[model samples]
Target chain A: MSAVIEIEGLRKTFRSVRHGKRVAVDGFDLLVEAGQIHGFLGPNGSGKTTTLRALLGLVRADGGRMTVLGEPSPELLPRVAGRVGAIVESPQFFGNFTGRRTLRLLARAGGVSISRVDEALELVGLRDRGDDRVKGYSLGMKQRLAVASALLKDPRLLILDEPANGLDPAGIREMRDLMRSLAAAGVTVLVSSHILGEIQLICDHVTIISRGRRVAAGRVDEVLAGHDRHEFLVRVAEPERAVDLLHEAELTAAVEGTALVVSGVTDPTVISRVLGEQGLWVGELTPLRPDLESVFLELTGAGEHPSVPRQVDDSALPAGADDAAVIDLDVRGVDA
Target chain B: MNLVRAELERLSARRFVQLMVVLLALAFAVTAATTLAGSHRPSEAELSSARTQAAEALQGMEATHQQCLARQNSMTPPGETDDFYATDCSEFDPIRQDRLPIAADYLPGVFSFEQQARPLLYFLIAFLVLFGFLVGASYIGADLNSGGVVNLLLWRPRRLTVLGTKLGTLLGTVLALAVGASLVYLATFWVIGQTAGLGGRPGDDFWRSLGAIHGRGLVLVLLATALGFAIATLGRHTSAALGAAAAYTVVWELGARLVLEIVDARRPDRLMLSSHIAAWLNGKVRFWDNQLCTSSSGTDPCSGFYSLTWGPSLVVLLVITGGLTVAAFAVFRRRDLL
Candidate 1:
């Protein structure tokens, strides 16, 4: 399948009188396949937004080769712009214009049908407030309106940057489902966000970037597997003895609460066999596959530097997600 | 086409512009009404005063001619054109040669339409240009302040096309408004003239002059509007353009005039932008009051204003406006939107 967005050797530098020269994106590369919801994850001040801006020709890149929907970008941006929808940073709009009027202006500029304005507003659940002026809209409503704008063209490729920034829980779920539905209908989606759980739940493919460089990228599971240290949580009668025996066997193991967690060994039966030979009965031996958050933190070195603030706060974790497991592994991963 | 339509919509939708239009129409009506009310048939006393003054002037000229003729006959025969008697006789013949009209015994029975319309036309031209500048500046200023340029460019990324369309839309709107306002002024002035006993019916010559006035009025409106747009584009903010315009008009022109007077360099006043603009609007040639007029060369013609012809006046005005426009487009095309 052809890639929807291709970036090779992309570089961007910004020079400000107050800040001197700072590199925003350096030697960055990205490939997003067609018909998939791809997650673009990065820490604060990373090049995620910068890369997206360069791709859309909002800012001219210092050096790069980029393509969107199989056409060379920025040079041919106008040709393909009609079929690509994007919301960069935050949505900017005319305050006096009604929500419906704003979309009509955009639709007219893009040569899209006027009827699509209403259709897009309906799609984003903003149909009722379409007649109100944009200045009266709340932040969430404005975000919804921005989504409606992107949907007006019924684009083949959708790029959103922190689309869930100001959304509540319900709004975020709606946005996630909308992205999933768009991708399911054969549209390629590239979403950049700090919400790791949302990205894991909605994205079939993920690309993790750090410090203006791509550290890991692939299918969601493949990226997880490449960085996954097969950890098994075993609850045995003698948890401390189990950890000691696994350590004596040259395997990385540790005790957390009442269970012993072992990594660097994939065979679950060997774990039971070793503990069983020592006259300790295993109550539970469940494989602890790394979630996207753990894999992300591991890959981006957020796990290595505990003091550096993480993009995903503990409060942003989705309900029923394993916060304890994430913290436990991060601590152990630091020691290892 | 889309960009032009969008710009027109955006410009017309502003509430400030709408309020300005209403206020302008009200102001025009009041001015026309007040001017007409004060311009009525002259009173009997005023007529007698004007006639007495005209008779005195005619009587004085006749007496002077008689005295010069007596002196000419008493002096030596004319030897050359420069001799005292010859010079006095040469000046006397022309003064007494043309027949002067008889002093009017009564004032005009009605206010003249041409007299009433000229001031009204000047009023329209001045206000229209001033207001046009504000409109043009505000149109771009609001967009820059609100960060709407980025949003608009996202839909159409051709930078030059966006700026060109905006300027075209502004020029078209200002020109249309100016023409419409002039028509209203003319219609109101004509009605008042007829109501006040001045004939409203205009001759072909009147029509021609009126057309020229409106034509020049339109050019003035265009130049002012373009100036505002260019300044706003270069500065990327409305206040900056407004501040610059105010400074040029108040500080630059007034300061330059004061400096020229202090230094006794009045000849260079012909090149002043304000001077040319004023001359163009008044349909008069601008002049420099050089000290050569007061020199001891004994040249009679040197004791008056030296006319700056229409050609140079128009050229200077266009050069200033055109240079600003080109600079604006260049900066807009190359500068980063941020």
Candidate 2:
């Protein structure tokens, strides 16, 4: 696939007389492929918005070779910006106007027809209440309205910073589906979110950053791979016999009160055959897969782990999903 | 057309603007009612009282001046005095050249409750302050704070037009208010002519003369409005912009004038826009018989009242307002509102 948004050797910093100076983005490189639902994931203030702003020419970059569509970011902003749409940070709006009126104004300014406003509003599920003043809108409704405004131009590349802000569970679900369909229709979406699990579910690729640098990038599964450590628990009525047989096969086994903790052996077949020939019946063989959270914590310097544990069910996905999911994404795969 | 309509809707929907519009209309109505309410019957008792006061005051002033002149003349040699000076005491005196504005003569005829609160012109100035706070904030400062301007900028993908349209909306609203105020002023005077006996008074003249007062009033309104808007754009903080405007008009302008007066320095009033417009509005004040004409300060840079005709001063005001507005738009278009 051709590249839609490209950044190479990008750098930026902020200087204020009162607060001193801070480096936001340091020599960052990113390439979002055409028609992919790309996820740019990072902890708060990790330069996601800064990079996106630089790409949109909303903020000047200290140094970079950045391009959107085809031309360089600075020289091609006007020419390429029409084909690109963005909703940076919070949804900006004129409080007095209705959702429909605001969308219509944006459409006219974008040189898009007024009819497109209705279509955009409907896509965002704001059709019913489009006539009400934006001031009366709930936070979620306002965010959706902003999404509608961004969609007015039918852009090929959509850059969104925390687009799902203020959305409830159901709204988030609908937004996820909408993003899928947009990508299917060949729209390139670059979404940034702190919610890593959501990115795993909806994005084709993800780039993770920490302290103004890329920590991990590529297909979600690949970023989680090698870190997907699993061990099988062997149980039998003759526990001592099983341990003796396992030890003879050069497996380091630890006693976890009742069950022996076998170190480094993942496949059930190898353990079953070696112990089965010794006339021992092993009752349980369980394989554990390390989740995205563990991998993320290990990769990024945000040392604290997420409190919620993941019940990873590899069986629910298709047979080849684990391997296929790992290799074929942008940003961080070894192949990439 | 759609964008322009949206701009109007957004401005009208603003809370501050809606409050201001309602308050402004009410303020105008209240002022008009009070100014036109008093009867011009000229009762016999009041007339008798005025005649007694004038006679007594004039007699007192005459006695004092006579005593002083007699003392001076007795000491003076006759050959030093010219026949002309004794014959015409008032001729070519610089004080005689200081003609008071005609607006002062009709000021008492204004007769509204607000008008009676003297220096109603200051209320008009205050309106500009409130108007600027509402309109300037909604257009740019609010947009930045909400990130609404960034969204609009993203959608349109043309920064310049968005900034231009924001300003265009402000200008359009100001013009509409001006025209409305003028119509109200005309209707007030018409009522006064038919009812308050202004026809017998000296101020009943060409409608154009009254219009010139409204015209100058309109300029004052736009200048304050535009200056506030420009400051708001630069500061990007509504409260800060308001503070800056207040500092310039109240602290800077008022302070300078006060210091100059204390020191008895030359040309203090020229630094003030209000004084210049005052000269322009003088002829139209219902209480003041005519515009004040002074030899000092208004027309010249150093003179506090160097005389500038209505047309020139108005043109100067427009240019200043226009220049500031354009500069404001330019800065706003380039900034990253986020």
Candidate 3:
């Protein structure tokens, strides 16, 4: 697939008399191919918005190169701007203008047919309230209007920063569906949001950024698979005995509440066979896979504490065997 | 062209511009009413009384002239002529009928379009200048402050083109409004004169002079509007333009005038912006300069006058407008819109 957007070694720094200098985006690199709904995930102040702004020419960049649809960004951005739609931040409109009037003005400015204004409004489910003044709309409705504006040109590439901001659960689902429909219609969407769950649900590809740099990026499942530990949750009537049996067989196991978590196991039959020989029949054995949230938190260091080191809990081990059967797995970070 | 059309539509839709238009209409109405109420056609009896009073005043003036001539001819010093010992007799010249004051002139008789409309035209021009400045400032100021400019840039990525189009639209609209408003103002006053006072036809020379003044007024309004837009664009907020205007007025107009007075500066009015504006509008204005004296005595203080003409005033205004506009455009082209 052809790359729709490419950013290489992009850097931007903001300087002021009071704040001195701040590196908002540092050597950040991103590549989005055509027909992919890419999710850009980051915490607050992680340079997600800065990268988007720099790419769109809203702000000048200090270093590196960026391109949109094979044209160098900010300079040649206008050439392809008609084919691309972007909303960098929460754009506020004239409060006195009706929603329809606002869209009509944007449509005229962009040289798009005015009929698309109604279509964009319908796509975002704002057609009914299109006549209402913008000041009277709720926050979610405003967000929807912003989305409607981005969809005015029926763009091939859509860049939205925090598109789900101020959206209710239902509205978020509607937005998700709208994105899915757009993607199905051959549009490449690059959506940045703090809502990792929504990103996991809708995006085919994901890029995770932290401290103004990309920490992880790939297909959602592939990124998750790199963090997967092949661990399993084992439940039995005698969890302590199961831990002892599993430890004797050279399997790392820790009793967590009512179940013992087994790690470093290549095959599931080994755990059942090792436990059944000693009359310890496992009631349940479920394989635990890593999700995007855990991997995102781990890669972004969101779960890291400054003053403390992560360690496996010795209290969860059997009483007398704690010294010899200590599992070296640092699961505290995952638990956090 | 499309962007220009959109901007014009947006400008017209602004509540502040709408309010300014309403105020302009109200001001025109008030001026017309005041002009109608202040003028009238004098009666024949009043004319007869004015003639009688002129005869009595002329008789008294002739008696004073005879006394001055006798004093000058008889009381001359040896070394000096009548110039030193007594007043010059030539101060009293051949009295003419026009020199005598008419009652209709003193009272609010017929309103002469040639004589009375210039000052009122100045008022109209002043109001329009103020209107243009404020509307131009808010036009771009509100957009930059509210991120509306950013929204427009997202649609049209050419920064210079967007800013240039906005400036062009502002200047064009101000010119159109000034022309339309001036026409209406002059027409309404003419109607008022015809209905309640004299509507004497003015000669071509008078209309030509008035037209020239109107042209200058239009230029001034355009310049003021551009200045406001440039300052607001540079500051990225409406309050910045307003603050700059207030600072100039208080510091330069009022404060510097006092400072210049204390220092006894020569041609102090030459250093003032208001004086330049007045000169530009009125062709030329004379200011009293007591320091520019050629001769003085013990009792009489030294005094003279200085005049500010149109050429220099136009240059100063153009330089300010051009400099700020260029700066605003350069900064806008490079600065990051946060």
Candidate 4:
């Protein structure tokens, strides 16, 4: 697939009265392949939105090589823009207009057929209430209408900033499915979201940004599996004593609550046998492979789940059992 | 289906414009009706009252004439044409003279809605002609200041085209609205004039009078609209531009007239909106009173040229609007919408 979006050495700064000068985006580079769901993840004000705006030609960059669908962003913005759709931040719709009418207006502006308006509404699951005035609609409904408007043109590339901002669980899932379907139809989808778990589940590729610069980017698995380490969390009856026993065995282990996480081991069977021989009854030993959630926190020190506290804050607590990743744990520990 | 429809649709997007149209229409209708009904020539009963006064004046003069005759026959030297026609009767009689042009001269003609309600001239000029530009300013300025315009600018990506389209649409709407409003006002005024007075036979200059008012109103509307549009674009908001235009047009004109009254200078240039429009309709070019407007009166801010060559006035007006438009677009092209 061709790279639908390509950026190199992008830099953007704002002349501010209060702050003197603020660089919103700096040296940001990214390539989004056609037909792939590329995740643009960043904290608020990290310049993710700024980069998107630059791509749309809303803001001129200070210095950068950027192209959309292989066309230079500035010179070819008009030609390439019709084939791309976006919702920069908050969804804007005429308050008096109906959801259906707003989409129809957008379709007209985008030079698409009127039928596309209905298609967009149906795709966003807003068809039943399409005639409702936007003012009466909920925030989630407004967001859906925005997506519907963006999809009306059947764009080849879709840039959405927090597309799922007001969506409920079902709505988010539906949006994920719709995005996947769009990607399957060969449309490049670049979405920015703060929800890491959702990104892990929905995106095919992820790019993590920090303070207006990229720090990590790659396929979901390639990025999540950091530095070639496989770790597993070992659950047993005596969590503290079990961890101490592993420490006595001359093996380095991290304890996260009741789970004794052992890393660097080649096999879980060895840990099970060693514990069994030592007169220690093991309840369960499960391998914890890297996922997007843990990797995201490890990289940015931020994660969606609140229960998963930072390891930095609770160093005394064991890291989830660091048992090395194994296909199967045939040596199941004794029943509790 | 056509561009006009699109223009109307775009205008429909704005709520204030709709309100303005409704208010102007009702106010114009009522004012026209009031003027036509109130100022119309008297009926036979009222004519009797006028006759009674004329008779009373004649009686007093007769008593004085008896005494003068007893004293001196001095009326002989006075021209015979100056002699008052002395008559006497008890019934009402029609007293007529050659028609005065003042009322019909300023009357809005042939337009049914503008009949008697000449206020349409000021009303339309105030809202329809000039306010459209002010409205356009807010449309673009609000969008630019807020986030919505930035979103569209990013997507469409051509600054010049965006600016040009906005300008063209705004100009088109202003002209169309001004013309439509003028037509309504003219029609009403003409109807009222025909019914109330205008009873004289069509004179040689009748067509000229009509042409003068029509031509002047149209030209003034066009110029005023362009001027206001440019100002709004410059101001970048609805209120500031509208307020400035209003102050310059209304307050400045009145103030200039007051100043000219004291200074003993003929202020051909210092015409505020209504007076300037009146002068222009008379085929004379006058400058606005203050430096606030586009044209400046050299040396003396108060002493501007009274009359402009018609050709130069037209050219200057166009150039000012065109130049300001170009400048506005240049700023629009590069400046960040956000």
Candidate 5:
């Protein structure tokens, strides 16, 4: 599959009087395949939004090779801009203008049909309030309007920065569904958000970054399974005896509330066998898998990773290279 | 072109713009009504008193001139024609000289289109110029203030194109409003002039001069709008432009004039922005009863009028506008929208 967005060695530095010199993006590389909902994840101020702005030519990067829709960006942004709809940072509109009027202005400027204003409004579920002035709109409504604007051109590539910001659960769900539907219809979407669970559920592919560098990226399941150790929830009547029995067999096990969390073992049969040898009847055995949130925290070094020693600062090896070796890893300690 | 059309629609539809237009129209109507009321003809008793006094004074003057002429004629040879002596008494009729029964020359009447409309024209021109600047400044200022430029730039992507289109659209709208408002005032004044004993139809020359005056007013309006657009774009806000204008007029210009008064012999107030703006339009600045010019006589050196060469003033105006506009464009093209 062709990449919709590609970036290599992207670097951006900002100099301000109050903040002095700060590197917002350093050695960032990203690739998003066509027809996939790609998640661009990062900690706050980790350069996710900066990269998107640079891709859209809103901010000039110091050094980078970037492309969108197979074309090098900025110089060719205008050529491909008509087929790309984006909302960077926050949605801003003329306060005095009604939502419908704002859309009409965009339609006129973009040479799109005015009739699409109503359609775009309907798509975002804002048709009822489209006639109201934007200044009176709530923050969630503003976010929905931003989504509607991104969908106005029926763009093949949609770049949205925090598209679910200020949205309630229902609104976030609607946005997720809209993205899924758009991707289903062969549109490529690059969405950045801090909501890891939502990204995991909505995005087929994810590229995780920390300190302005890509730490891990691939299919969501693959990334989650890349942990160094496997884990299994072995539920038994005597949880303490189950832990001691696993210790005797050289298996790491700990009581997590009511269940014994067995780590460093991929096969659940070993856990069952270890417990059954001591006459400890196994009530249930459930395989524990790592969630995207835990994987993100571990890669970012913001959360505890007892099994894997993260070396994000090591320049010799590629980031996340150590985790790529494992097909399954222990994640029983991670919450569902 | 469609962008220009959209901008025009947006400018015209703005509430402030609508309010300004309504206020301008009300001002015009009030000026017309007040001017018409003040132009009421002299009372019948006052006219009669003035005519009787004028007739008596004329009879006295004629009796004296006739006696002097007769004495001169008698002193000359009978065969020689005294060409300097008054040969006819028919020209001394005061009633015939005072044909309109009122001082129609100073009042706004049908025949006084050129006389009375001159002040109204000046007032309209000044008001339009000031308001044009305001409208032009707010046009881009509101966008920057409200963060609308983010979406606008995303939609268009060409910064220079967006700026150029907006400036063109603003200039076009200001010029149209200036011309349209001028015509409305002219029509209103004409209707009011007819009701005030104004009966004669002005000739083509008067209409031509009126058109030329309005044409110059249009130029002034364009200059003000350009200045406002340049300043607002350069600062990225209307308040900046307004603050700068206030400083220039109140501090820079006034302070410089005061300093020049203490250190220089020349009248430096003539170099103020207000003076230059008036000079650009009027082609001269009138030094009305000032200490600098009241001591001098005639229309020569130190005269009551300082004529500004139209070509040089026009060049100065364009250079200022173009310089600010270029500076604004350069910054706008490079600066990142954050």
Candidate 6:
């Protein structure tokens, strides 16, 4: 597979008189291959939008290298721009223009056939409301119109930033299906969102950014597996005795309520034999596999601890850590 | 070319531009109605009586001129030369027959295209110039403010091309509208002249001069539109261009004029932008400057009249338009969109 989008050492800083200088993105790298639905996951203000802006040339990058569809970004991005569809942010349209008029103008500007306007509108489920002015449309309808605008060129690479924003649950599902269909049709998709569950479901490859740096990136299962400790929840008569017995067998074990959570188990027979001989009687044993959300929280420093199950809000971030301030650890084993 | 077409469509779609077009049509209708109400053709008897009175007045003026010329040497002072008392006799030259001060002429018997059209054309030009500026400003201003430019750039990806096409579309549309409006204005006034009043047919020179004035007016419209577009593009909002215009009027036109008047500056109109614009539109303008007097005594105080011609006016207007346009393009090209 060929690389459709690439960024290395990308750096950007915003400056204002009142706020002085603040780094928005620092040394961020991303690689998206052809025909892959790559999820770009990050916390809020984690430089996801800044990286996308720099890649699309909406904003200037202070330093770094970026490319889309094999062309150097910004300078050479125009060369391949026709083949790339992007929605940098939630773009606002002229209030008076109808959705159809807006898409037709974009099609004209992109040198695409005007006939595609109808098709694009249909694809985004905005065919019925295409003649209505944009201002009257709801936020979800505007999002659909934006998607229609992006699809005007029938581009091979679609870069959407927070595409699911302002979308209802059904609209989000439709967007997911649309992206999946696009990927299945040989178009590479780079979708950035903070919705981890959606990313986990729709994306085969994932790149998680925290605090302007890539913390982990690979297949969704592999990234989750890297943070997986291979633990098990055991239900026994005596949870305390089972934990001590598991500890004597050189296994890490903890007692929680009425269950014994044991880690580093090579086989299930060891737990049955060890606990059965002690008359503890293992009633049930279940493997506790890691999910994307837990891995995401742990890597993003939004979790209390890996062993303790907690919500994202339970962890307290350090002061001034809103700007990502994440741990930079790369879990390799990703296919090039 | 596609980008230009897109921009043209977008510009025409703006409600403000449409409102301006409606206003222009209203102005034309009002002008025609007012002009019709103020003019009428003279009756044969009224014409004869006016001609007789004009002839008598001309005879009396010639008699007065002859008497002055005859007494010129006798009225000379003791030490002064005879020529000093010889006033310019040409000032007493008989008025042309066409320009005779007949009651009908003064009471709007004939609609002289040469005389009436200049002011009307000036009114048309002012209206169209205002229309161009506001339309141009709102056209680009709404785009930048609404992220339409960013959306266009995503498709086109050539920032310069996008900005340039928008500007080109604005100028071309403004020029076309101005020319069309001027034609309609002239044709309507001509029809009025032929229908309800004496149609004084002007010669080729009058047509040529009128054409030239319209041409200058069209250029002024284009320049004003381009300036408005450029300023809005730079500031990324329509209010930016409007604010700048207001600031210039308050600070330069009013405040500086008052300050210059207080200081009794020499040729203060030289630094005034309104003066340059007036000179550009009217060919040339003459302003009085008290500072140019060589002798300030009561006996013989000299007055100075300075003319600001078309050359300097064209240069000043072009430099301002070109400089702002280039700056706008440069900033749009290099600066971050967000």
Q: For residues B1-338, write the lDDT of model 2, one tens digit per residue.
A: 65576667667767778788788788878866665665463445655565566566556555555554664467545434444334233333324433322322433433322222224544654575467555775556776556666666665556667767777787788778757764664566556545653334333343454455556666676676676677667777666576876787787588876876787655566556665566555631112111232443332322112354555556666776678778787877556444
lDDT of 6 by residue, A1-336 (tens): 899999998987776565445666668889999999999987666678778878988888999999899999999988999999989779998888899999988888788999999999999999999999999999999999999888889989999988998999999999999999999999899999878889989999999876676788889988998988888899999888888888898889999888888888868788888899888888889999988888877877776565876442243333345544433211111110
Ranking by DockQ: 6, 3, 2, 5, 1, 4
State which candidate, 2 or 5, has the greater TM-score: 5
Better of 3 and 5 by DockQ: 3
Error of 2 at B59 (Å): 13
Model 5 chain B weakest 10-residue run by lDDT: B100-109
DockQ, computed on Cα atoms, for candidate 5: 0.20
Higher-scoring candidate on lDDT, 2 or 3: 3
RMSD of 2: 9.0
Regions of model 2 farther than 4 Å from truth:
A94-96, A226-268, A273-284, A304-336, B40-130, B200-209, B249-334
Candidate 4, residues A250-321, lDDT tens digits: the string is: 666777876788878777777777677777777777777777656655555455456875332221101332
Candidate 2 lDDT (Cα, 0 to 1): 0.67
TM values, all candidates? 0.81, 0.76, 0.87, 0.75, 0.80, 0.87
| Clashing pairs in model 1, backbone N/Cα/C closer than 3 A | none
Best by DockQ: 6
lDDT of 3 at B165: 96
In model 4, how large is the Cα lDDT of residue B78? 39
For the candidates in turn, chain A alone yields TM-scores of: 0.88, 0.80, 0.89, 0.86, 0.89, 0.88
lDDT of 1 by residue, B177-236 (tens): 899889977887777667763443767877787788788878988988888888887877
Displacement of the residue A163 alpha carbon in candidate 3, Å: 1.4
Model 3: CA > 4 A from native: A305-336, B37-39, B46-104, B109-112, B294-302
- Candidate 1 residues A1-336, lDDT tens each? 888999998877666565445665667799998898999997766577778878887667889899988888778877888888888767778878999999998887667889999999988889999999999998888999988888888999999989898889999999998998898899999999989999999999988776566777899988888867788898998888888888777888899998888988878888888888899999998888889888876766578657866552221222343333221111101110
TM-score of 6: 0.87
Give me the chain B TM-score of candidate 5. Answer: 0.75
Lowest-scoring 10 consecutive residues by lDDT in candidate 6 chain B? B78-87
Query: Which scores greater on lDDT, model 3 or model 5?
Result: 3
